[model samples]
Target: MTIAHILHRVADYDAWRKVYDSVGDMQKDGGVTQESVHRMVDDPDNLLVIHHFDTMESARAFFGRSDLRDAMERGGVQGEPRVELFE
Candidate 1:
C-alpha cells in the first residue's frame, strides 16, 4: 500500500471544505482506500490530507491529474500543495 501526505492552504477553509466534500467520488476513482483530514493549529487555513492507495503508481497518477488541479483551484486552494509518499 502507499500513503500520500498532502499539505496545502486554502483561502477559506469553510468554502474549500464545501468543494472538497463535493468531490467524494474523486478519491474513490483515484483508488484511494483510506483518508484523513487535519488543520493546522496555528493557521486554520493550512490543511493536511492523508490518502492511502493500493500502489504508488495510482497515487502518482492521481496527483498528476489535471482535473484535480482544476478542482483544487475551484475549491480555493491558495497555492501548490506539498505531497509526500510513504509505503
Candidate 2:
C-alpha cells in the first residue's frame, strides 16, 4: 500500500471541510482507496490529510495534479502545502 500525506494551513476549517467534502468524485477518480484528516491540537488551522492508494504511481499522480492546488485554494488553504508519500 502507498499513502500520500499532505500538511497545510487553512483559513477556516469549516469552509475547508465543505470544499473537501465536495471533492468526493475527484478523490474516487484519483485512485484514492481511503483517507483521513487530522488537525494540530494547538493550532486548529493546521491540517494533516492522509490518502491511501494501491501504488506509489497513483499516489504521485493524484498529488501531482495541478488542479489539486486550485481546490486547496478554493478551500481557503493559506500557504504552500507539503506532500509526502509512504509505502
Candidate 3:
C-alpha cells in the first residue's frame, strides 16, 4: 500500500470539511482506499490529511488531477499543500 501524507492550511475548516465530505466518490475512483483528516493542535485551520492508495502512481495521479485542485480551491485551501509519500 502507498500512503500520502499531506499538510496545509485552510481559510475555514468547516468549508474544507464540507468539500472533503463531498469527494467520496472521486477519491474512490482515484484509487484512494482510505483517508483520515485531522487538525493541528496549535492551529485549528491547519490540516493533517492521510490517504491510502493501492500504488504510488495512483496517489500521484490523484493529486495531479485538476478536479482535485478545483476542490482544494473550493475548500479554501490557503496555499500549496505539502505532500509526501511512503509505503
Candidate 4:
C-alpha cells in the first residue's frame, strides 16, 4: 500500500473545499483507493490530504502531475504544497 501525503495552505478552506470536491474524477483517475483530509487545529487554512494508492509508483505519478498543480491553484492553494509518499 502507498499513501500520498499532501500538505498545503489554502486562502479559504470552504472555497478550497468546493474546488477540491469538484476534482473527484482526477483523484479517481490517479489510482487513489481511499482518501482522508485533516486540518490543523491552530490554523484552519492549513490542510493535510492523504490519498491511498495501491502502489508507490502510482502515488509518485499522481503527486508529480501538472494537472494536480492546476487543480491546487484553482482550489485557492496559498503556497507551494509539500508532498510525500509512504509505502
C-alpha RMSD for every candidate: 0.7, 0.8, 0.6, 0.9
Number of backbone collisions per candidate = 0, 0, 0, 0
In candidate 3, which residue ranges exceed 4 Å CA deviation?
none
Best-to-worst ranking by lDDT? 3, 1, 2, 4
The whole-model lDDT of each prediction reads 0.92, 0.92, 0.95, 0.90
Off by over 4 Å in 2: none
Better of 2 and 3 by lDDT: 3
**Candidate 4, clashing residue pairs?**
none
lDDT by residue (1-87, candidate 2, tens digit) is 998899999999999999999998899899999999999999999999999999999888998887777899899998789998999
Predicted candidate 3 versus true structure: per-residue lDDT over 15-85, tens digit per residue: 89999999999999999999999999999999999999999999999999999999999999998999999
Per-residue lDDT tens digits for candidate 4, residues 15-85, read 99998899889999998999988999999999999999999988888888899889899889987899888
Give the runs in model 4 whose Cα sits over 4 Å from its true position: none
Off by over 4 Å in 1: none
Better of 2 and 3 by TM-score: 3
Q: After superposition, how far is residue 74 of candidate 3 from its true place, in Å?
A: 0.2
Question: What lDDT does model 1 reach?
Answer: 0.92
